[model samples]
Structures are given as C-alpha cells and as structure tokens.
Target: MALLDYWVLAAYMLGIVLIGVFYAKRNRSAQDMFAAGGQAPWWVSGLSGFMTMFSAGTFVVWGGIAYKYGMVAVSINLCYGIAALAAGYFVAGRWKTMGVDTPAEYIELRFGKSVVQLYTWAMLVYRIVGTGVALYALSIILVALMPLPEGNPFRDPNTGNLAVEWAILAFGLVVIIYTMAGGLWAVLMTDVLQFIVLNLSVLFVLVFMLQAIGGVGTFIEQAPAQFFAPVSEGYSLYFLMGWVCIHFFMVGADWAFAQRFISVPSAKEARKSAYLFGILYLVSPLVWLMPPMLYRVIDPSADPEQAYIAACLSVLPAGLVGLLIAAMFSATASLASSQLNVFAGVFTENFYRPLMERRGGSGNLVTVGRWITLLIGLLLIAVAISIPYLGGAEKVIVSVTSLMVGPLFAPTVWGIFSRRLSARAVWSCVLLTFAIGGAFKWLLSLPADGSISPSTLAWLTKHSAVIELGIGILVPLSVLALFTFVIDRNGTPGWIPDRSKNATSNAGAMASDLPARVVAVAMGLCALLLMLIALISHERQLEIGLFALVTSGISAAIYLLGTRTKIAPEFQRAL
Candidate 1:
C-alpha cells in the first residue's frame, strides 16, 4: 500500500468518529441511547440488522470457504436469507408486539427473573468471546496488508505487523469510542455508511476483475467445475440446511438481532424491516462472495483466509485499496459495537438498574451504560489476546459458535409462540441436550484407533458439523415438545406481558424522511471521495472513473427524492 492509501484510511477513521460525535447530542437518555427512542426507520433498522451479522469473519471465514469450496459459500449465506424471511413472518413481528425495550425484559416476563439472570449472563459471555475472536480475526487481515517495521518491538516476528494483541486493542478502542459516544444511533448510522462502502467496493472490484479476466463467461468457463456445484465434500447439503436452522435461532432470538426487531415502531414495521433484511441477504451474497471465487481462478494457491483481501489488493487502485480495507474493518467494528451496545443496555437495564431499585430508569442510566461499554470493550481486548489460533483454532471456534447457538436460543424462540411452555422447559432443554451432546461427542463417537482410517477420519470431520447441529437443535426442541405435549399437559398460558405501545400512540407519529436524507448525504460524500481518488490515480482511469460516475448519479437521485418527501405538519414539528 502507498502513502495515499494510508491517508485514505486515516480520513475514513476520522469520518467515522465525526459521525459518532454528530449523533451524540441526540442521545439524552438511556432509552434514546440504546433504543433510538423507537424512532428508527424500518429500512435503517433492517440494514443495521444485516450488517450486524457480518464481521471480519465474513472476509476470513466465509471468504475462505468461497475460495476453497466454491458456490457452497454463497449457498451458506443464502440460509441467512431463508432464516430471516422465516423470522419476519413468524418471529420478528412477535418480538415487536411484545413491546419491550430489551430482550431480557421479555424473557423475565415470559419465564421469570431467574431466567432473565441466566440468559443475560449467558449471552454476555457468549458475545464477549465472539467479539474477541472477531477482533483477533480482523488483526489477521490488517497485519497481512500493513506490516510494521521489522525492528519495531510491537511488530510480530512471524508476520512483521504490530502483534495481534496491539492490533486488537487499537480496534477495540475505536469501537468503544463510537459506541460510548453515540450509542445505537452511532452504531446504526455507521452500519449504513459501511454498507455503502462495502457494496461500492464490491461493484468496483467486480468490474475491474471481469475486465481483466475477459468477462464473466471466461472466468466461469475457466473456473473449476466444482466452483459451480451447490454442495462440496465437507460443506454438504445437510450442513447447508443445518446452517439455516442455526441462524433462524440467531436472527429471531439473539439479542443483537432481536434488538432491531424490538427497536422499530410497530409489529408491522418490524416485519418490513426483517423482510428487507431477508431480501438483501438473498440478492447480495452472490455479488458479495463472487470476488473471492473469481480470485480462485486468478491464484488458487492464495491462503484461503486471506483470499478476499488478496483479491481486492489485486484489482483495486491505491486509495481504493485503503477504502476497501477500511470497509472491512468497519464491518468488524460495527458488529462489535452492536454487541457492546446490547450488553451495556442489558447491564444498565436488567442488572444495574434493578440493583439500584430503579427499574423505572435513572438519572445516570446513559452515563452508566457508557461505562459498561468501556468495561466490556476492555474485556474484549483481553480475551482477543488470550485466544490464539493454534492448529487452525479459528475454524474450531466458528464451528463451536454454530453448534452452541442452536441449543442456547431454540427454547426461547419456542416459548414465544407456545404459552403452555414453562421455564422448566428452557432449563431442561439446554442442560440436558448439552450433557447428551458432550457424552456422545467425547465418549461414544470415539472408537479404537485401528478402527479408523485417514479417509474415514476426514469424512467424519466434515460430517460431524451436521451431526452436532442436529443434536443441538433436535434435542432441545424434542425436550420442549415432550414437556409441552406429553409431560405438562395442564400447563397454563405463559405470561407474555404487554409493554407494547397503543395504536393511538403510533397513529400520532408520522414517518420521517431523515433516514433517506442521511443516505443521500452519505452516498454523495462517498462519490466525491471516489472521484478525488480517481483524479490522483495515474493508472486504470477508465475503470475507476466509471465507478465514480455511476455512484454520483445515484447519489443525486436519492438526494432529490429525499428533498421532495413531504412530512405531515405535526410530524415535521416533532422532528
């Protein structure tokens, strides 16, 4: 990377911080800080939900699969679409209808305070570890692209970049600042900005790649036949289906996602937001994952985990390379910020507020929330350094996440629609299924060493993902079914409290065009930035110029539309 590229990265980081400062004043209370005061547009909320599902993992993990396994990578991502669509129809709207500020409140209402305690700590620990892994994964990418001087003490002897520990801390502090300053609104707005950067990067790189390789047809004809296959050896059809099931629980019940569902104004809007998320997932993955697959044709021997970055570095110009890298970091930071905001909200609302006997909220709620954000941010940095990727441990951690998500949240989702289900069912399914899964995995699954061949061992490793998913999901659901239908036939309706807003309250608030205007300005500025880069670059002028031109045209149209959008008199006054 050149000095211009580093300048672009520096400018991008500064812009993100400015955005956080811009939104900071709007947050006056913990509710406004954490929940957007129930004012976020459906599209913004939906887009935010989509981005939260991404991280450095998308580049490192999924992109690695795309490079090695082919269409299965896109196939795996498509499950998020199916899972999200299902959630929109059955689950997302229900979460909105429950009308709680946080998912913990809903758990407490449906089960009890004890379940709330259990779920909060469980989710907090889960997300903290996951976020740390994500941070560590991001440093892996950055170090490959931007290594430090060989003699610098901070530089890693292996890869020569600032050691992963320092890189993780730097990223963590950036997340903490923006999240603490602007809260969810900052998180939401940055998500929108990152979406723009990511897709623009995708569009530009795809065009350049297609040009260099002759065209789409040439690349496809040249690619390995396996690249087009729906399923591969290890990522089989069963694994694909299991991926869908796991994310259904994730999209519908995980607090980071559920927060989006509950942040919207009404049940109907919640459905729309989730539907938008689903539709984007369905359409976007093909475009998003194709670059790595194309890179396989260019350099099949490239490290799988570094394939996406390697592809971008090959096609994108100097400043644009920095922009693309910035976008990737933005993806990881946005996800971490979402989790940070969520646990902070949970701590502030469920733990701290209640302990102070001020469950109604307090004067220092926002202040307290920011402090919690900082604490968790530090914890994430610590955990990132402790967790090492020895013997491809990152992949192991990814698989663990998939296995654990299914069992952890399946019962919570089941309770959403089933009033007859009780707290006992949640506890039973989680603990019992975990025990059985551990026994089968460690005890029964292992056979005498002479009984297993190398080929069989590899096959088992590949196929075990699906089996673990099956046990995690089926065991919990079966337990819930047994308890509800056979064991506890006399159970009463679970108390699903009504914290929902009245229809009259919603009728008084008209839709605002602020989100549209926000998008317009964001796109317009991005185009201008691209054009500036185009002027400075001496090579590939046509390729870069076309991208800038099309982007600017779209920005202009969005701005015009936003300007003409008429607000009701009362709503205008309110905004």
Candidate 2:
C-alpha cells in the first residue's frame, strides 16, 4: 500500500471516532442510547438498514460466491431484497406502531416477561457470535491489504492466522470506542457516510474491471457458460427454495434491522425506509458483484473470495486503494457498531433494567447502557479472536447462525402477524423446533469422508441442511396454527394490542406531490439505465461511471426534496 493510502485510512478511522464523540451529548438517557430517542429521519434509518444488511460478507463472501457460482448467486441475494420489500409493506408498520426500544420489549408486550427474558439471552448470544464472525471476516481482508514482514509474529500458519487475530482486536477497539460513546445516533450518522463511501468504492472497482476486461461484450465472451446460468451445476432447486424461505423470515424478524424500524419517527417513515432499502438492494448487487465476476474471467484459478482485493491492487491508483480498504473496514464497523448497540439495548433495557427495578436500585440507565456496550464489544473481540481457531471463517459463521436462528423465525413471524396463535403455543413451537433443528444440524455436520455411500453422501451434502431448515420452519408454524385453531374456536383470538404504551403519530404525513413523484420515477429509470448501459455499452468505463454519478445525484436530490417538505414536530426534534 502507498503512503497516501495509509493517510486516507488513518483519516477515516479518525473521522469515525470524532463522529461518535460528536453524538455523545445526544444520549441523555437509555432510550436515546438505544433507539435514537425514536425520532430519526426516515432516510437516515433507511441507509443504516442498508449498511447493516450489506456487511463485510456481502463484499467478500457473496462476491466470491458470484465469481464461482455465476448469476445464481445474484438470484439468491435478490431474495433478501424481496423479503425486505415484503416486510416494509406488511411488518415494518406494526413494529413502529408498537413503539418499543428493543425487539425484546415487543416480544414481552406480545407474550410475557419470562419469554422475553429467554429470547433476549438467546439473541444476545446469537449477535455476539454473528458480530465476531463479521469482525473476523474483515480482519482477513485487512491482513491481505496491509504490508507485513515475511517472518512477522502475526503470520502464524498452524492455528489460523495471527495477523487476523491482531486485526480483529484493532478493529474491535475502534468499533467499541465509537459505539460505546454515541450509541445508535452515532451508528446512523456514520452508517449514512459509510454507505456512500462503500457504494462509490464498489462502483470504482466495477468501472475499472470493465475497462480492464475490454468491455461487457468481451467479458461475456471470455467467461464460462456456467457464469451466466441462473441455476448452475452445484446449486440444487431445494437449496434455492430453502434459501428464499430463510431470508424472508430472517429479514422480517432481524433484530438489528428491526432497530432501524424502531428508531424511525413513525410507522409510515419506517415503511418508507424499508421501501428505500428495497430500491438500493435492486441496484447494489450489480455494482458489488461485477468486478469479482470479471476477475474470474481473467484468472479462472484465482481464489474467488480474494477477487476484490486482487482487483483493487491491479486496477486502482495509490490513494484510492486505501479508500477502498477503508470503505471495506467501514462496512464491517458499521455493522459491528449496530450489533453492539442493539446488544447493549437488549441487555440494558430488557435484562439489566428489570433487575434494577426488582431491587429498587436507582442506577443511571444511560451510564449502565454505555457500560454494557463496552462489555459486549469486549466479548465480540474475544469471540472474533476465537473464530480463527474454528476453521473456515465463512462456513462456520453461516452454519452456526443458520442453525441457531432458523427455529426463532417461525414463532417470531407468526407472533407478529397472527391473532390466533397463543404465546403458549409459540413457546411450545420454539422448544420443539430448537430440539429438532439442533439434532438435524448435528446430523448434517457428521463426517462425510467416504464413510457413507457416494450417492447418499452427495444427496446428503447437497440437500439435507436446507431441507432441514425448511422443516424447522414449516413444522413449527403448522403446529402453532393448528393449536391456535383448536384453542380459539368461535372465540376472539389472543391478538389484543397492549394499550399501556402510547403509539407515536405519523410524521410528515402528506400526499405525494409532483416533484417527489417525479424523483421516484427518475430513480427507478436511473437504475434501469445503469443496468442497460452495463449490459450493452461498448465504452464500459465511461458509461458505468456516468450511471453511478447520475444515480447518486438523483438519490441526493430526492433526499433534499424530502427534507424541504412540511416537517412534523417529531422529525423537527430529531433534527
């Protein structure tokens, strides 16, 4: 890396720390610490949602998947966008309407304290592991980007990379400082900035890669046929079906993303945020995956996961490489900070506050929240350091998270949407699914080193886990639905809204006007134009850059116009 690159990265790290410090004064209480005092602008929340979902994994692992597996990877990812849109249209409004600081509080309101407590502990563990894996993934990229001596102590081989371990600690400390300082307010602001940098950096790589490969037509002609297929050789129909189901449930109930819904000013703004997230999802994959896909055409034998780094080194100038690296780091930090804040909220609001109330302790809740944030950040660093020893960071992270959260999906979704399903029935379903899912994951994890028959092993390897996940979700939901029917025959279902907490009124409530409508239409057309130009244009570099600029400009204009409208009192307070 060049000296200029180092300077750029240093500046970004410093800037993020300052942003966190800048927002520190805003967190006067636990409520503000956790949910931005429930007055965040819709666009801020929307961008944060996008950044949280588009983690380091999207830049590295998903790019690798696209490089190796072809367009099927793209198809699979679109499931997330589809799920987000569905949630925006249906589930987001309800979450905002509930007006809770944490998903656990909402769970408590719907069920009871005991269930919420259990769910909180479970989610805490899940997020700690998840954030640790994200940090570990980012460390891998940083290790690749940085210059280390050949015999440096941080380059161990036998028990995973020591450089990765050091990188994790360094990145974790930075994330902890800011996240512990500003809470969710800092997270949203930094996320908006990070989203812009990462998206632009990705576009930079895409344009350069297209230029290097001659053009889009040349890329197509040189790439393997499988790279263009929607359903390639290794990906089975059952896997795709299962992937879609898991994503829908995951997005609908994701705690980190749901925090964005809770932070927005109103149910209507929450819904708008979701729609905005969906629009970004539609366009981002093209820019994110194209460089890696093109890299495969150039060097078919290269590591797919490392394609992004290789392209950066090959195509970008000195300072921009550092900028791209910073963008990657920013992606991971944004996610880790969000996770840390959410974990702090769940632990402080759901767990610690209740304990204090029981004992009649007069502890300052904001102070307690900050302490918990630091604690979670430390735990995440420890988990990240330990992840290297687990082998194959990507695979382990994905398998463990999927196994742990698969069971929670059905109960969470049903609990939110269905009036007939009782809390007791949901609890019963959760336990049953946990047991069965655990056993199924164990079975799938069993050694396949030719101990089993070839055909049976192939089938088991390809389909069992996805099929298991499908079963994990479906069987529990079916049982709950049936139980609800049997118990509530001819009587009103147990879907009564809790009347104790007041819901916030809709903010900036107005019918869409000419400029707003035009901007929306123009945004869609710009996205389509980007896709069309990338597909057909011979001057790939110039056209791709133009598309990126136009898309970004239009998006900025839309945001500025939205800000100029008659502002609600709640939104004004947030500002």
Candidate 3:
C-alpha cells in the first residue's frame, strides 16, 4: 500500500476506535449496550441496517456473480428491498409490540422455550459461520492489495500475502473487543459512520470504473446483455418469487435485523425506519457492481476481485485509497460487531441464562450477555482463521447461507403471519427441507466431468443447490399442511394464538407527512437524469462522473432531510 494509503487507513481506524471508546464509556447496562436504548434516529438505524445487510460479501461476491451471470445476481439483492418493505409494512409493529430484545424471546413467547432454544442454536450457527465468511472476504481484499514481508505465514504462494491475514486477524480482534466492550451501542454507532464511508467510497470507485470503461454504451456493447437481466440461473419466474419469499421470511424473522426494530423508540418509528431502509438497501449493490461490470466489459480476462482492487487503487489517490481500505475494514467490523452482539443477546436472553435460572432478573441476564459476547468472539476468531482452508471464499458463504433460506424461511413465515402451525409441524418442515435440499444438491453435483449438456443441465448444475432448496421448502410445507389437517380430525386444532391479542400492537400515530414518497420520486428523477446523461453523452468519463454526481447527490439529500427533520429526535434522545 502507498504511504498516503496507510495514513488514511490509520486515520479511519483511529476514528472508529475513538467512537467505540466513547460509546464504551456510556454502556452501563444491557439495554444501553444491546438496543442502544431505542433512541437511534430512524436515519441512523435505517442506513446502518442497509449497510449491515449489504456488507463486503455483496460487493465482492455478488459483483463476481454479476460478471459471470449478468444481472441475475441482482435477484438475490433485490430480495432485500422486497423483504425490508414486507418487514416495514407488517412485522416491525409486531416486533415493537412484543418488546422482546431478541427473536428467540419472541419465539419463546409465541411457541415455547424448547423452540426458542432451537432458534438460539440456529442463531449461533448463523453468527459464527457468517462471521467466518465476512472475515474470509475481508482477508482476500486486504491480503491481495497490501504490501507485506517475505515468507509471511499468512501469505500463500498460490494466493497473495500472509501479512494481509494477520491484518485481518488484528482488525477482527479489535472489532471483537469494541463489540464486547461497548455492545450494541458501539456496533450501531460505528456502523452508521462506516455506512457513510462505504457509500462514498463506492460512489467514487464506480465513477472511476465507468470512466475507465469508456462509456455506458461502450460498456453495454462489450458486456453481456444478460448482465442487465436480474434473474436466477433457473430462468423461471418461480425462482424470483422463491428468492423474494425466502428473504422476506428470513429478514422478517431474523434477530440480526429485528433487533434494530427494538432499538428504535416506538413501533411507528421502527416501521418508518424500516420503510426508509428499503430504499437505502436497493441502492447498495449498484455502488460496487459498477466497477466489476465495467471490468468485465473492459478486461474480460481479468480476475473479478483483482479488477475491483485495481479500480479502487488506480482511481483513488493514496490517502483516499487508505480511507477506502479503512472503509472496507470498518464495514467488516460493523457487521462482525453486530453479529457478535446479536449472538450474545440471543444466547443469554433465550438459551444459557434462561436454562440456567428460572427467575433471574435483568441484571443476571445482562451479565450472561457480556460473557456470551466474549465467547462468541473467540469462536468467531477460530472460524475466521479456518476460512482459508475452506477453499473458495464466495462459494462457501453462498452455499451455507443458501441451505438456510430454503428450509428455515417458510416455517418462520408461516409462524409469524399464521400461528396455526405447531412445533411438530415446524420441526418436520425444517428437517424435510434440509433433507430434500441436501439431496437435490447431491444429485446436481453429479456428471461433474463436463459430460452433461451445457444448455439443459447448465442452470440445474449451476444452481442445483437452489433447486434442492426449492424442493426442500415445497415438500415440507405441503406435507406439514396435510399432516396438520389429518391431526385436526377432531375439529379442534392446537397452539393457535388468540386473534385479538395477536393483532394488538403498540403502533402509535406515525409521523404524518413521512417524506418517503417525495424522497422516492426525487431519487427516481435523479436516476432517470443520470441514465439519460449516461446514454446521450459522448464522453465516457463525463457520463460516469455526471451519473455519480446525480446519484450521490440525491442519496445524500434524502438522508440529510430524513435525518434532520424526522430522524433527529431519536438520535438526540439516545445521546
């Protein structure tokens, strides 16, 4: 890395650490630590929520996927906007009304302790594994670009540099410490700042990429037409629906996302914040994809990741590059800290402390939460270290997370909206989904020697996991519904919630004249203007620069207006 780059990165780290230290001093209780005292402005929570879900994985891997498959990769990310809207529209109010700190608590209240415990188990798996993936991706970028010593252990001859590995570990440790120390306050606060950095850097790099690629027309001419088509490999409408359904269920039910709801002041604010989040989430992918897409069009033979790294390095000056690097690290830290925080909260509130003590007060549980944070951090470190041995970075994340969505999604969805399903049905569907999904993947992995026709089995082989997942969800839900019908032979079903109580919510008067519609229209107009400039302009750099200016200006304007007017009250109260 350049000297300026190092300086910029150092400043970035210093800034984040100072922020964490500031929050650490204020983290006196579990509520302050875990929920940020529900005082986060809708803008802060909403933007950070967008960044937390987007992360480096989406930028790096999804970009690579875009390079290979065109726009089909967007199908995955578009799910977030759809999911966020659903959550904002429906689940946010319920989460606020329940007033539970974690999803496991909701599960326990709605189902039983055993079920909550199961959810906690799933959460632990999710946190450690997810951290491993994030760590792996971060390591790849840092190691590839940063300068290092000879024979460094972290460096692989076939790969890049080992110094980068140590850098990743060191950075991760710092994140764990702050997360463990400051709790959610540290995570959320740092995440908001990081989101700003990430967005700015992404915009900067995207503009540079378009300039390098000549123009939008040239890029489009050289790039695959399919790159703009946001459909999955199977090329079926069902795949899109399935993708949307899975994310809608997962994000709505996920503790990681739902905790934000609890951390907001009221149900109405949470809903408003979540609705705002949908727009922010939709824009995140475009930031990173511009570079990768341009790289594919400009230098089709180039490594996708390398292209992204080069784009940043070549386009951004040394100090700014360092800032971008810091931004990248900050992004990873934000995610890691959030994961660690949520994991601890879920474990203490729903698992270890509950199972250990029947009547323990909040104090005892809070103490347990602290210990779980440390423990989860250590486990994540171990997993992060092992990520290199797992072969390709992106493949592992998509594969592990993919299995989760297909099987877990439907039941979670069913449980929330329709409470008729019993624990038996839930477990049955989960197991059945896993079995079928796994089987489908196994079958698709066959004919591995390139014997299969590229056209017929191309999509199936490419997305065998998705197919199995589809079957897994479908079979289990169908069987469970059938089984539920048979078991209700006596004309009386079990475990249904009282309709009146189930519908009740603490939804107060939402802030009237929410600017969501106006902001949407403004952003849409800005996007249209940029597209026109990009299409009509003759100069490549001018087109991209103009596009960047418009997109960023609109995004910044919306955020500023939202924060100052509607969202500031929440943040000031929290402070």
Which number leads on TM-score?
Answer: 1
* Model 2 residue 46 distance off true place after TM-score fit, in angstroms: 1.4
Worst 10 residues of 2 by lDDT: 509-518
lDDT of each: 0.81, 0.73, 0.66
TM-score of each: 0.93, 0.85, 0.81
Off by over 4 Å in 1: 150-153, 358-363, 389-394, 440-459, 499-507, 510-512, 566-575
Between candidates 1 and 3, the TM-score winner:
1
lDDT measured at residue 430 in model 3 versus the true structure, 0 to 100: 69
Model 1 TM-score, 2 decimals: 0.93
What is the model-wide C-alpha lDDT for candidate 3? 0.66
TM-score of candidate 2 on Cα atoms, chains taken together: 0.85
Ranking by lDDT: 1, 2, 3
Compose the digit string of candidate 2's lDDT tens values, residues 1-575: 76767776777787788878877888998878988887677777888888887667666777788888778677767666776788788788777777577887887777778777667777777777777777887888877666665677777554334477788888899989998888898888778778766876787778787878898999989988777777764455665666666666666677888888888767778898888887787777767777778888888888887876887677776666776877888889888998889878888887888888999884888888889988889999999888757666546544654455556665677778776666677677767777777776676666777755667766866766465656655767677777767864444465455534535244443232222333444344434434443444344445554755677677667656655553543434343
Candidate 1 residues 1-575, lDDT tens each? 78788888788777878878888888898778888877776878899999988888788888889999889889989999999999899898888777678888788888888788778877777788777777788887777777788799888898777687777887788889989999988888888888888888888888888877889998889898788898887778887888888889989899988888777777777888899999999999989898899999999799998889888888887889888878888888878999999989988987888877754535588889999999988998888877774335445655566657866788779889888888888888877877876765674356647656767766656677777778877888899999889876797789865644445455554445666677778777777888888899987877777788887888888767657665445433233
Count of clashes in candidate 1: 0
How accurate locally is residue 59 in candidate 2, as Cα lDDT from 0 to 100? 63
For model 2, the superposed segments whose C-alpha errors exceed 4 Å read: 149-162, 445-453, 487-495, 498-501, 504-575
